[model samples]
Target: MADTPNGATPQQPAQVKMQVLAQYIRDLSFENIVAQKGTGGDVKPDVQVQVGLDAKKRTAENQYEVLSKYNITSKNKETGDVLFAMEVEYGGVFLIEGVPEQQLHPFLMIECPRMLFPFVRRIVSDMTRDGGFPALNLDTVDFMTIYRNEIERRQRESSAAQPTNA
Candidate 1:
């Protein structure tokens, strides 16, 4: 390792610390359309999952709340009929320290949700299985890609909103 002047070691930035204070389901809904209708049988299901992430600072110092919302729908591919629909909003309370101010937003959006995803996945699986359907094991979500896409979308919208000289 290269040393600084007088052979002193280079300083290292503080290591970031994060802790999950609490995590729980904020809301959940499961509608079994198949049971109600009893229409589709042995039909291939097309499942669509939509995800949304949000974070807010808590009243307590160094605490923040992150929410992961999922809307899932399963439809018979051939019939275009819904088999099931599910919505879940899971939240986590985090105590974060040593993150730079500029990096905090991305940190909250990416890292906190990464920590909470497994639990959310499990809950979804359990809910679907208990609803008399095949357990839905959700694929891992790419938080960084989602964050980047959202930022790009917002930038495009902002640019489009600005008035240009005719």
Candidate 2:
């Protein structure tokens, strides 16, 4: 450790602490379109998944809430008919400390959701299995990549919204 000119040692960063206070499913919906419409023989399905993330500061000190939303759709590959559609919004209340102010947003958006992903995956798998389809195990999400893409998207939107001085 290097000492400053005043002979004081550099201060070490505070240890980061994170705890999950609570987790819940905010909303969920599943529709079996194939059952309603009755698909013909040899139905091959194609699945698509979309995910969204949001975070908010709670009123309590050092508390935050994060939400992960998933939209899943399955269609028959040959006929282009909808087989199933599902949406799930899961939330987690977290107690977080020691992270710097400049890093809180990223931490909340990325780390918090990463922590809550397992529960979300389980819920999705259960819901699918209970809804009459084979269990759907979601692939692991890359929160860092998602965060970078979101930042780039916001920058592009902000720049496009700006007025040209010319």
Candidate 3:
């Protein structure tokens, strides 16, 4: 290790810094398909959920916008009837600095979305509760896993889309 003029070991500066400039609800929807009083109130519904992620460079220097979208549908497996549904698109403007290009994608996809998830989850839960149902809590998502899976899927699609001849 190299020592500075003050006889102290030099420390590395921050490699990356992320700031959430603004966050807002880009879109939201909620529907209650079944009446709570119609059934016997013993209906255990199975919920299907889908989640998506995206990031784009804004017209600003060292800044990017990240969006996380989710869809939830509740259905009664036995009766085959729709109970409720919800969809949300949440986004945040992030200012990132000092990160290398190779690391920027992960930072934007994983870190930025991780920061915005709590708010989105809250919105979903509140919306469901307000829509005449119990509050729905979203499970903690593994951003790293999702990011890796998406990368692999895109690579496979691109490779298959290319032409090959014997």
Candidate 4:
């Protein structure tokens, strides 16, 4: 807002802004640990995908780097043979401005990762398909639940590590 008629800043009206400054794949690896059996016939493999989130402050002001890590394992449940395994750490640099300090952590953990997930998911699907397996379609992630779980886990750990009165 243009300075008040009398030249006062007016607190900037509490603008809340968040933006993705840049995004990239920090690490990506696909491993076929064991040979995929079956001679060009219909195969049903059990696929397991694990997703994790991590974030750290960047050197620039109001910038942060958040990594969405994924570990996927595909196997034949009947034979317990590993068909394929993939690990990717996709990262995004976010510019967070005008948000309260209390809200910043959640913004980075939940919102930032949520924004970057689709691209990472697409890459994973493409990688799996390129590796001679059926494309692995991923479902939407529930980041809020993950965030809450992490908070609870950390709280429990903090309490467990503290010394009790003798």
* Global lDDT of each candidate: 0.96, 0.93, 0.90, 0.87
lDDT of 1 by residue, 34-103 (tens): 9998983578999999999999999999999999999999999999999999999999999999999999
Worst 10 residues of 2 by lDDT: 34-43
Clash number by candidate, in order: 0, 0, 0, 0
Residue 69, candidate 1: how far off, in angstroms?
Answer: 0.2
lDDT of 3 by residue, 1-166 (tens): 8889999988786677889999999998887887643665577888888889999999999889999999899988888688998889999999999888888898899999999999988998899889998898989989999999999999999999999997
lDDT of 4 by residue, 1-166 (tens): 5788889877655787889999999999997655544334445689888889999999999999999999999877776677899999999999989878898899889999999999998998899888877788888989999999999999999999999999
Top lDDT model: 1
* Pairs of colliding residues, candidate 3: none
Error of 4 at 24 (Å): 0.4
Estimated TM-score per prediction? Answer: 0.93, 0.93, 0.88, 0.85
Worst 10 residues of 3 by lDDT: 34-43
lDDT of 2 by residue, 13-99 (tens): 999999999999999999988778787798888889888999999999999999999999988899889888999999999999999
How displaced is residue 23 in candidate 1, in Å?
0.1
* Candidate with more favorable, higher TM-score: 2 or 4: 2
Model 4 misplacement above 4 A: 1-13, 34-42
Q: How displaced is residue 80 in candidate 4, in Å?
A: 1.9
Ranking by lDDT: 1, 2, 3, 4
Displacement of the residue 133 alpha carbon in candidate 4, Å: 0.5
